[model samples]
Target: MSTLNLLRCAPHALKKQPVWVAPSRNIALSSFLRDAPAATASTKVLPGHEYYPGKEEYGTVIGNREIVGHGEIPYYSDSFMVPCPAIRFKEVDEELGKLREKEKGDWKLLTLEEKKTLYRASFNSTLEEVRAPSGDWKRCLGDNAILIGIMFFGLSVIGLSDPEFEPITVTNEWVDAQTEYLIKRRVQPVDGISSWYDYENNKFKPTWSIFTTKETSQSVKTLSERGV
Candidate 1:
C-alpha cells in the first residue's frame, strides 16, 4: 500500500493529534459487548434501529394497568417500544465481571498517560460512577485510590473493544486546545468599535484592516493551517 493508504488503514497508529474526540457520548462498549445473549426474541439486538418505551408506558405496565385502555396488551408493546431482551442485571454484571477479569492483568500494566489518551478507564469503578466527581478522575492521582481503580477498570473494557489501537501519549498543549474548542461558543458581534484611528476628515473612520490585534490574527492563522 501507498504511505497515505497505509496510514489511513491504521489511523490509530499515527502520531497523536493535539486533541481527542470521543466516538460516542456516554455509551461504553462494554455495556453492549459484555452482555449475555438474549433469552427471547424481544431481547435480541435487532439489525435496524430500536426504541425505548417512555415513562408513561413503563408506569402503566408496572404501576396501574387500569390507566391504560382495556384490552389484552402484548408483552413487548405494553412495557417498551424496543425488544425487551430477557437479560437480567445480575447476569449482565456477572458477564461483565468475567470479561473484566480476563483483561485486568494486562490493562494494569499500561501507563497512566496511556490510559487517558486511549479512552480506557483511568482507574477502577462501576461504569455509572466512572464519570462522577466532575469527570475529573485524572486529578485524583496519588490521593483517591477508589477513583484510580475505577479508571483502571474502564481501561480494560475499552481495550477489549479494539486490540490494535494503543492509547497515544497526551500533551498539555493537546488538552488545552481540545478544551478551548469544546467550550467555544458560536460567534458574536462586538458591541462597540474601539480602535486607534487615523484622521482623514473631521470624521474618525476606522482603520481599513479587519484584524483587531496581532495575537488574534496569529491564532486564526495557526488554526486555519493546522485544521485543529
Candidate 2:
C-alpha cells in the first residue's frame, strides 16, 4: 500500500475524538470462520454498521447483545466507555487478512502499518481525537448572544410603542412628595432614615449628635434626649 494509505489507518491517541459519534451497540460474530447456516438471519449490530468485513464470516458474539434482523453494523463512540465495540469499522480485506494472521504471533514481528491497521479495524479515532477540544462553545455563545439581543430588541420595541406605560412615580416632584408624606407620619422613628428628622424644627437632624465625633460625647447625650 502507498504511504498515504498506511497513514489513513489511525492510532489510539487520535482515538479520543468524539467525531466518531455512535450510540450503544450489538452484534453477533459466530466464533468459527465458517458459513452461517441458512436457518438464521444474523441479528443486526445495534450501532448501525457492518462488523464483519465480508458476508461469509462472523466473529463470536460478545456481551448481552441481542441478535435480530440482518442490517445496521456496530459503530464507535466516545460517550460510551465500552472497552470493546460490537464490531470492526471495516471487513477483512487481503492486506488486513494477512495482518490478522500475523497478529496471532509475537507483537515484535508485526510492522507498524500492520499494528495500525488492526487498531483502525476496531476503533474510529484515537482517544485524544475523541476528547479533542472542538470550538463548539463559540457557536453556543454566538447563538445565545443573538437570542439575548433579540429579547432586548423586543423589550425596547415594547417600551417605545407605548410612552404612556412609563412609570410616573420616578419624577422628582413625586419623590419629594413621597418623602414629605413619610416624614409627616414619623415613619420608622427608631434607628432609621426617618429618625434623623427633627419634627419640631421641621428639618433633618445631623446624626453627629448620636455618634461621638472628634468634638465630644455631649452631642450624643443631647440627641438622646430628643426621643429619637
After superposition on all CA atoms, what RMSD does each candidate show versus the true structure?
A: 27.8, 14.9
Estimate candidate 1's alpha-carbon lDDT, on a 0 to 1 scale: 0.36
What's the lDDT of the predicted structure labeled candidate 2?
Answer: 0.52
Tens-place lDDT per residue, model 1, 121-153, is 211222334335554556666468877788999
Against the reference, the lDDT scores of all candidates come to: 0.36, 0.52
TM-score: model 1 vs. ground truth: 0.14
Best by TM-score: 2
Native-to-model Cα distance after best TM-score fit, residue 36 in candidate 1, in Å: 75
Q: Write the per-residue lDDT of candidate 2 for residues 18-103, one digit (tens) a residue.
A: 22212223324452223243222443433323333422344343222212112344443443354445445566567766776676
10 residues in a row with least lDDT, candidate 2: 61-70
Per-prediction TM-score to the true structure, in the order listed: 0.14, 0.35
Off by over 4 Å in 1: 1-144, 163-228
Residue 74 of model 2 has an lDDT of 42
